[model samples]
Target: MKQYCQSILIFFLGLNLAFAQNKTENVFIITTDGFRWQEMFGGVDTTILKDDKFVRNRDRIKNAFVGKTAEESRKKLMPFMWDTVAKEGQLYGNRWAGNKVNVMNPYWFSYPGYNEILSGYADDSINSNDKMYNKNITVLEFLNKQPKLKGKVAAYSTWDVFPYIINDKRSGIPVNSGKDLVQGNLTEKEQMLNEILKNYPSLASDRHDFITYYLAKEYIQKNKPKVFFLSFDETDEFAHEAKYDEYLFAANTADKFIGDLWSYCQSTTEYKGKTTFLILTDHGRGDKIKSQWTSHGQKVSDCYQIWMAAIGPDTPALGEVKTEGQLFQNQIAKTAAKLLGYEFDNGKPVGREINSVKN
Candidate 1:
């Protein structure tokens, strides 16, 4: 144990030295819960609302929502997401043509998926159906230990488990979610949002985690943390409710939020060109036949497939190509560590850096 402590100390010393010698760049990792490629690529049917169990709202299904194309709707729903940033950035569903998950397995749910992404290895030891507050050292914790990144990294999630996923007590970065506690002077828009939150009881204490985007956006302008992890939970929440229309709306909202964040970053001097934003999901839903919002957990080809997109200084322009090689959720930890120039206990190298990111 003493030897282990000494090794960690030495590793951190090296990490700090590296950061001191390099330019300070910001990395924002944003995740939308249970987002699927189909929704982002192929527009959803406005009419048919299905649950995970494949149960359909027949009446609504009969009406058939002939909605705008995904691309068109993406632009309309989120002008900034599709317009400004996307032009210079990339979207995963299309960035890597034909790129998708390997296969679905028993751990095709939120907890397992999150574990796989942050811990650099999936834990079969995690078999419980409970919210995870422990078990692994997250990428956030790993990065936080580096003296070079002092006060520059933070996490905000709409989900209650963020405190656990990030281990806030141990990590020390501010995490705001669930309750509304906007800390600074409210802009007119922010004031209106506060009114909306105050007027609407449902949005306040639902135990649903889905407001991290707005919170992070607000915090970014105020605190300007160099590394920010923003997790949105509405898609997953609506999926569980089996409300297809609601889920679609939730996705639209997510796109808008992302658009807002990107736009704000561009206008902010600290962020603009120096920032790199990455978006992805913890996991995806099962095949359509399984249900719109019904089931996931067992191995289903659909459940494993997820998408990722990156935009900013080190990214390439809008285009399509296959990921060079094998990639896994574990790579996220290593990739973030690399970008921040931090060291980790998991010394395994990252699978492949997203193409075009400058060293």
Candidate 2:
């Protein structure tokens, strides 16, 4: 009888241990600034490809992204996203298919869009992408304050304005932004990366996306933050410059970076089987026609339409969601919190948690 009781206790203890392991969920929120849903889902618009004003080297652009069909083209552009994430996770905001994901902010600009994404609401006052500090608390701030997550939340962004947008001073979260030297002890590779950052030419407004990606990846490998935000901005910059070829290249490269990050997470014990990745854009740019593809703001129609993709243990492998429904960008904050087994309440009226991503 004593041996039987001992066996039952051991079984219950195993169950408890499993539960604790499950609770240690890691969340990665990544964004590509102003990346339109058009190229994301449909791939390089043929109209833009033929337009001499946008395409200086037509053959080069076509060979890189253009295929027989939209599906084939997009797959070529984002092989990891289309081949792996699409099969293992869910993707929303295919407007042609009736699924729509939009930003709540009417401004449809970078600062406002990112604010709504992180704070779960639209603030009309944050219309400009200036260096002004954000007043509202972000989901990152909320998570950093949590007992288990304190000092374990980090943000790395390519845009220089992120330090202001995230209000790093107020949140007390570590934010590494444009041209900033990496601090603290570093590995040999990290040291080399730091030297490159110092010598690399300034091609974009902020830092190059590749630099931002590598910095974030190195930090994650070393610190293993509970929650991390990696934001890339070259897509938006290239679009604004009307450099279609560079824009597509940046988008394709971002896909590869995300794929590499996902693979790394799966290979590590701390992140394997417990990490969730939420990939999205800050806002969408203009349509292919109407000569507005380079701009995004309140005046740009359809600029609010964005795309979001998720992959994790909690999310169902529904692939591309074609169901008739509308999703708002504000839900991202609550969704991130939910995936980590917590509720994000900013004490203000905000978006609800995304039910589809929860277990």
Candidate 3:
């Protein structure tokens, strides 16, 4: 009788552990390439768009500026962002703070900027005005190795070089982006779209990570991946063109996409009340407005200033606290790992686990 009682107790304990493990929430990371802190928060009081360059899209710039400080403008331009996350969790201009080095310094162009953020260490040995080719271990690689996280991590980018940024082949995680093409079973719509891509071969579809967005949303709803990394490359492309109106449109579109993702997460029981979102830029641009059209390769360039915002259930609800906590782009790897209860081994691992959702 004593042996039978002990066996029953052990069985119940095992079931309890499994239940706890299966009740995991998710973390979503989104990046807007070459996003600028100045444009995001610089008051309309001094906005160039408020003056000579003002157009239909730039008009939104003026409306975006409500109060005196950068924080105020940010709140105005992104009401949902401010009310939902920044006000309660953490939001700041990484550039105004002393995070210049890790904030895509050298103002070096996109590939290097992305590599540093992903690899978590700046490499002086590399400096090419070309796309990256070598595969480097990323935060995704580390997170995917955690117990039960395998086949649960995925990445989507708009750039052609994303295959190299993550080296998805080695990681075995599904990566979709420009020209990479989505593989596996497809819906009827997808099958039609694939046929279209082959026939026209010239028509521009929403080839950006918008497809990645759909895939991520579908996977979360179906398979429920624990970690999701999404990179929107359209804004960066428009920025390079120096078409202010186009750039603004791209930013606004990306904002809407983010809003949609948040809404979707809130509707799901597994992640509705538990998920956290981290939004950031890959690097800054130039100082002069003209040069800003196509720049970001100088260390002292004013454009190197970047911005970051986080929202979710675990972050403190302080509306817009002016705390001076330092945050580096490299810290993202550590912070994400901490939030998901995993260990990250990045070169700069001093990232604090900022509250994502209120505990």
* Every candidate's lDDT: 0.63, 0.88, 0.63
What number of backbone clashes does candidate 2 have, counting pairs of residues 3 or more apart or in separate chains?
0
lDDT string, candidate 2, 144-175, tens digits? 99998999999999998888988999999999
Top lDDT hit: 2
TM-score of 3: 0.78
Return the lDDT, model 1, position 299.
Answer: 52
lDDT of each residue in 48-146, candidate 1, tens digit only: 433333224544432443245656644554455556656777655432356554322257777767766666556666655475675577777777677
Instruction: Assess every candidate by TM-score.
Output: 0.76, 0.93, 0.78
- Can you tell me which runs of candidate 2 are displaced by over 4 Å? 1-24, 288-290
What lDDT score goes with residue 234 in model 3? 69
Q: Residue 50's C-alpha lDDT in candidate 1? A: 36
lDDT of 3 by residue, 1-359 (tens): 99999999999998666445432367788887776766665533254454444335655555554466766765565556665665556666644543332453354666666766666655554465355654556778888877778888887766667777777877787877665554677666565555654454422223654554665566566667778888887666665655555566566667777888888888877788677787888777665664454456664366556677777765566544355555566667666766666657754533444443224
How many collisions per candidate? Answer: 9, 0, 14
By lDDT, the better pick of 1 and 2 is 2
Candidate 1: regions farther than 4 A off: 1-24, 45-81, 84-86, 94-97, 102-106, 180-199, 203-211, 290-293, 299-301, 322-326, 347-359
Clashing pairs in 1: 47-65, 51-293, 51-294, 52-293, 52-294, 53-294, 54-291, 158-209, 159-209
| lDDT score of residue 337 within candidate 2 | 87
